[model samples]
Target chain A: MSSAVEEKRKHQKAQKKADRDAALAKKAELNMTSLMDIFVNVLIYLLMNYSTSPVDVPQSKEHTLPQSSTKLEVKHTTTIAVTKKIIMVNRKKVCDVVKNTVDPSLKKDKQASSYLITPLFKELKEDVQKQKKIAKYNPSAAFKGEVTIVADQDMSFRLLSEVMYTAGQAEFSKFKFAVVKKGG
Target chain B: MGKKIRQEDATEEINIMPLMNIIMLLIPFLIMSTEFIKIGVINVAAPKIGGGASSSEPKKKDEKPPLNLTVSITEKGLTILTRGKKIPEGCDLKGEATEAKLPTVKKIGDKHNLPVLKQCLQTIKEVFPDERRIIIMAEPEIRYSIIIDVMDHSREGKTADKDMFPEVVLSAGVL
Candidate 1:
């Protein structure tokens, strides 16, 4: 019994020594400012490179796009104009007039009733052929790239059908109907 | 004194964890905004300049060389032009005798006469059977419905049979 009491006294004395050492270690400080500085530098670098470029949106004074609720911004290399009487594909006029010379005896306005679209098809065919000549990044699928159509709001379905049909024939399946952004 | 010197050395070493975090966020931003490739287009036309430039002017044949056709629709009616020349083949009859000769029917449909347009196309095709296909030009003022009517009839013959589809190709042209 006497020996146990002596051992307990010795353990208590060691505990007091450990407490003093711990108090001295607490006086030593860990600096956090350097770690904070590194974090701020990294954050600034990230923010600088965040948003790179603006969306490409082409507009013209001659044509006003129809109103639509779509959010997609078109990125077309070629801009097609749908005018009051002419369809300009990449600034080239393909069909100038619709006429019928045969059977002048039929009527004075027989030619006007008939619509012709041969030149536009030829132009589209040419475009497709030219793209195939370039090296690298060939689109094997149909409706590739930005094809913006500035179709007039009043154009007849008959005429529009021909336009859509022609575009489809040219392998231009993807289409963006140009429209003014609401409230902009 | 040796222990104090060792502690100072530990404080001098830089922490790199924050620098690594910033790089991760920046990479996604650059990739999302980038447009790497653009599709190229080429315009094709009939070869105009041949070597030695065939200077000889060929005699005018009775048949006219193929001319581009343009059709414009307005509130008034459809206007037709061929190479800027006026052509009137599918209009209403003028004389009273022609009106009287028309077949009497209970209904005169509002639907545009497709046959009239087809007949006009037929004549154009006959003149240039090998090259009858044409690009259709119309004004935006024209109705979408009317334009479809015109194209449906632009073919020289019956469109019911796919085999007999008139080879007319449609195109849009600026006024």
Candidate 2:
């Protein structure tokens, strides 16, 4: 009779332990606060490291760049185009008032277009300053306030050197020279 | 109230100690293995005047004679000048008796051939084994790769010889 009574007591204790484990498992399944905290932290990391551009180039027919294999699709806020015979500062053909290509001998001949580089240089300087102003308003903006030059492959080094000198005079130290891969 | 108390006791706090330990170990490992690029260079000296061109001064009979090798690259072909004269015929591109040169037709790898410029450097390597220094005045319009190839051929087979390594100085001028 005593043995039977002890067995009944052990069976009741085991049933209570099984009920406690099932209730704990159900509580864990419903508690989503910890998982939500982990997800929020991951989302924050992704947003902070994302490469977002503040100034994107608007679609325009005037800015058709020559295709190049080495050309990186850069989101430049300030762009300058130095064509075969003309210099385009901020999409305006300021180098040549007319549609004539830049003639290298014009500098030697003392043409009016050669001296117009001073105003072009001033415009480039102002564009860089404006980029900095826009970036200042937003801390997340990665604008370096630099200008990208798109030059023709056949352009003489002497002409290219002049552009470099003007950019240097305007205090724009960062430059990326675009070139197509050889044999491309 | 009883159920809420049980839930609080069952869950433990998230541990960040192991993550921090791994990051600390990784930072030091990266710092230790970082490598910087190294550039190689060599110092050079010009040879002294001897029994060659400036013969106006008196000569020393007991001194060792200096070897004079002339390496020229013309529009026509290469010309090797030794002892102040051209080598024998059949070596020049035009087969002229006045010009000492190699067959301007040798290929670089079946694609690029040694132009008159490269042939001049190679001929200099063969004739005067000791005269390893050369001055090349090339045309401005010649491709930069052609100039580099001439310098490369200057010390071709004997690059590791240390003594025969040629020192070729290049300059650009109007042809």
Candidate 3:
């Protein structure tokens, strides 16, 4: 009787162990495969879009940098980005833009349809003042009146000139147009 | 039974901790390395505020370079002008610029004819080898893409070793 009881106990224990192992394996199998696949995909995407440039602009769906064969490297400066929707000065929203041009109301001299954008000029002037203040403390880091204009390839030339002309009015003289470096 | 449960728990915990650690490290690494877009620059001279000439140097009276190379883009097409004189292109060979202009090169589509434009600039380069500056002007409605493409095409020829006119000064529209 004792030996028979012992055999019954052993069989029960073995069945319980098998059931536990099977449940654990099922759970792990389901999660591991899908999770691993997801992680691998995410990592690949991140690797491809990684950039090494010191200065960069976020390229949106509507905007793309014009391709250039020139070997000029982008320098750090006050950035003015013109999108289809709006114009930005140093990553701050300055004014709204339209399809082919800026709204006249947003400009300084609205009646004349002036090229000088009011908000952009004010913002850039503030930036120049701040830079000048910083330069005063550190003589070696004198302010350079440089501005980088980032815009879509399809943006109109008139808007570009307006931005440059306004920047010029606000003490910025050096103009650099951002582009994607590529072969012809 | 209690000892066996503890051992299983330990193994499960170990499996997740290492994986979590790895993912934690990897995610930050990828994020730190990622930037939205890479961009280069084309240094363009600021438009002359109140200009006699867009050139950086103050002009002497009655003195001008032999070639005041100017390239203009309008609704018609590109018109390369030297000292206000247009460079006429193939078959449109009339003495008058307005009468006969450089027609857009047609291969598959109505593109800017950049390569042919480059070739014309190259020809100009041979004679005015010392001239490094070129003024680019376009109509108000012209796309910035066309302007920059023209600038890039004329900036370098074949390679960086062969520069055509790297210095570009943007001029206001003719209109």
Candidate 4:
């Protein structure tokens, strides 16, 4: 009986050792090479398309852009965004839009069917002057009189015209209307 | 001696823990920085003030008038007019006249009949292949988004695989 009990203990010990070895082998079996390859490819792709330019306009829920089939790429310029409630120049609110028209109080200079809004004109003028000053100092950077308008689809032409006219009066002759690129 | 030789020949495992941590951090950073919505631009020249004529010389009586194509958008639909004369039976401008007596276009599929409007514009484009400018006259109540869509349609004719009217002049519709 004593010899039999000793044999049983030895068998249990061997079984436990085998189980532990199997667990360890399983733990060491992970192939990180494939995972590392996938990560490297993803990183390469992301790095290639990474935009370093700081002039990208932040899209928001209120400022959904109209879709277009045009192939023209957007360039860095002063952006004026018109939403349902407000008109913003470079993300700063210049005036409020109500009932498809800019608030009368915001228009300091009132004329019949006036295209220029006072607050917007002042903001765009400052931007143009600052750009001109920068171009004067930096020979490589030239002021191109470019302005980009990113307006909501629900906005009316009256407000757009006023904004464009105001920007034009501010000496921004070249206008670019921002649109969401459609399709591949 | 054989066991010792095998152990010596084993390659050292590289410590990729730091690299893994860096890559994990970089992925989220890149995703957050990436602009998913690709922004495009439609160039527009500021409208010339004072209505200055292109040429200094007086126009000859026999010379054909410039093709001043105007696409007027009202509540009913789109109206294609050339030199102030409406294109007969081409447009489907069908809606109740507004208080201002301006006919508006019916909205088909979240927008005015853009397909029909494109077809109409394409026909006009074939007639005046050389003319590239179109004046988009929209009502004050018309959404700016609709105007842009009309501009896009008028700017290029897809069936022809050519630009119909590249130059767009925005104007408030005749009141």
Best by lDDT: 3
What range of 10 consecutive residues in model 4 chain B has the weakest lDDT sum? B48-57
The Cα local distance difference test for each model comes to 0.47, 0.45, 0.77, 0.75
Of 2 and 4, the candidate ahead on lDDT is 4
Report the C-alpha lDDT of model 1 over B94-150, residue by residue, as the tens digit.
223233332211112644454555565555555545654354454444554354345
Question: How closely does chain A match the true chain A in each prediction, as TM-score?
Answer: 0.51, 0.48, 0.74, 0.79
Best by TM-score: 4
Candidate 3 — what's its lDDT? 0.77
Off by over 4 Å in 1: A1-62, A97-116, A135-146, B1-175
- Model 3 chain A poorest ten-residue lDDT run: A29-38
Residue B161 lDDT, candidate 3, scale 0-100 = 91
lDDT of 1 at A87: 72
Off by over 4 Å in 2: A1-71, A97-116, A142-145, A179-184, B1-175
Write model 4 residue lDDT over A1-184, tens digit each, in one string.
Answer: 9999999999999999999999999999777777888898898888877765444766676678889888788888899988878898998998888767886656745663666689998998899889989999997888877788888888887777778777777888777889888884
Tell me model 1's lDDT, rounded to 2 decimals. 0.47
lDDT sort, best first: 3, 4, 1, 2
TM-score of each: 0.31, 0.31, 0.77, 0.79
- TM-score-best of 1 and 4: 4
Alpha-carbon shift of residue A66 in model 1 (angstroms) = 1.5
lDDT of 3 by residue, A121-169 (tens): 8998899899989999999878878789889888888888888888888
**DockQ of model 4 vs. true complex:** 0.41
